[model samples]
Target: MVFNRPKKRAIVESGDGGLGLGIATFIANGEDLGPIIRHSFESGKPEALMQNLRSIVKKKEVEIEELCRLHYEDFIFAVDELCGVLVDAR
Candidate 1:
């Protein structure tokens, strides 16, 4: 079996990691997240974020699967960690 490396995504600029801009830049990706944010906040449902992520990423099955294969561990860990933090704050 062979591994294909994912291209480096520049989600963080120097010194910005501590400022929370890394994830912001990663998710923004040239599109305004305002509507998604407002809707999810208004809906107040955890699935709102999941559904948005599904629509954005799952539409391309091949890429999605490959991405998940490569990134799922780290991604899921981040999600789980954030979930704990978010749930605690609620």
Candidate 2:
């Protein structure tokens, strides 16, 4: 695990598949991702690449105008919300 923890936040913005806030910080705050991402792959540890990616998505989701919105709060880790109908396609 990257830093030995389960990161709860997301890295890519849900809005338009763009980089999230943590990305700038991740690149500018310290080690650049180019090396980190490359190292894991070159060292024969692909899992570490995914694990270390958590660092760039460590911030809480922010509301963005003119983009699709998701009810992150409604998410239940291991439970599925059973339903039989779809509505509100606005």
Candidate 3:
């Protein structure tokens, strides 16, 4: 689905990975997320994007919670490892 952003004049897409997971994966892979998020808001789809993000978070909550139990550095490292997988996939 395409989310129209009138302000930024961009049409952000919720990609093929179901809902908006594709976009999230893209961002997690080191792509710049700020522009996409800003455009989503500018285009008036903040709630939609947020919902998708929340879903993604929920799916990862258990994993993230476990990571949090470790040291902060470990959590950061785990995140980096996850994102790195995406980058490698690309």
Q: How much lDDT does each candidate structure score?
A: 0.59, 0.45, 0.68
Give me candidate 1's TM-score against the actual structure. Answer: 0.28
lDDT measured at residue 22 in model 3 versus the true structure, 0 to 100: 53
Q: Which of 2 and 3 is ahead in TM-score?
A: 3
Q: Encode model 1's per-residue lDDT on 5-71: one tens digit a residue.
A: 6554564433411313433454645646565456456756546455546655655677768888999
- Of candidate 3, the 10-residue stretch with the lowest lDDT total is 8-17
Lowest-lDDT window of 10 residues in candidate 2?
59-68
Cα lDDT for residue 86, candidate 3: 94
Off by over 4 Å in 3: 1-12, 15-19, 65-90
Alpha-carbon RMSD to native, per candidate: 17.5, 16.0, 15.3
Name the best candidate (by lDDT): 3
TM-score of 2: 0.30
Q: Stretches of candidate 2 above 4 Å error?
A: 1-31, 55-90
**TM of each candidate vs. truth:** 0.28, 0.30, 0.45
